[model samples]
Target: MTLFGGLAGVAGAAAAVRGTSSRRISPYDLLLMTAGTHKLARLMSKDAITSPLRMPFTRYRETGGPGEVMEDVRSEGSLRHAIGELVSCPFCLAVWAATAFSIGFLFAPRFTRVAASALTAIAGADYLQLLYAQLQQSAEGTS
Candidate 1:
């Protein structure tokens, strides 16, 4: 519980500081930040290079299509547990990512926009790719 409490305390402190200088986040912008954070977490947690960090805490199974694999986190109350909890769950990290991005927008709008735009574009591409694959499979079945 100390780990979680510590994280919360840090987050609260960051928020308190941010509140002093940050403007109110609009709903529309919040939506964008949500999407970007979702993509960022997915990429960060599951990518080939990064998965190794969280894989120890998860079950490894081949994705069945290629050399890809999936990680299913095994949760426990162990205080020394891995960062899989934070990295594996987009919901867990979204607020932090959004806050950082919001601050980025405040101080470095150009870089933040470029990075967020890239993440958003990659997210769209991911959806389109998945849709295309499903369509192809359906067509193959019909043929």
Candidate 2:
């Protein structure tokens, strides 16, 4: 959950930065991105997660005149894939919608206003992106 929350924060920051650089993103774009991200996440699973070999660990040692010493450490663990099977799952979408609603309602006037505004912007951006994609497709078809 924390991981997802952190990612959401990054997404929010990205949206803010993008808005400053150019026209505010449309809600459509936000929807598309969210969909895409959810899809990608679903494709990932726990079994897919893996840890890097040659565990890099720093060790401190007492040195008479030098700085410090390092020791080698080895551990065995299973790879945990962050992406779950939520991409194709409708449950993921339901959870997202529910979570958003919960947050909006719980936060109400305090944070809801900002959250709603952000969501609207995202939805607009998403719509624009979708429209652009469709336009591109149509153009290609005519050619």
Q: Tell me the whole-model lDDT of each prediction, alpha carbons only.
A: 0.67, 0.41
lDDT of 2 by residue, 94-123 (tens): 466534533333334336445544555654
Q: After superposition, how far is residue 19 of candidate 2 from its true place, in Å?
A: 37
In model 1, the worst 10-residue window by lDDT is 60-69
Off by over 4 Å in 1: 1-31, 55-68, 72-79
Expressed as tens digits, the lDDT of each residue in 1-143 for candidate 1 is 46656765675566677663455556756666667887887776566556677666665655622223566766664532456566666667676677677766655666877788788888888888889999999999999
Task: Determine which window of 10 residues in candidate 2 has minimal summed lDDT.
Answer: 45-54
lDDT of 1: 0.67
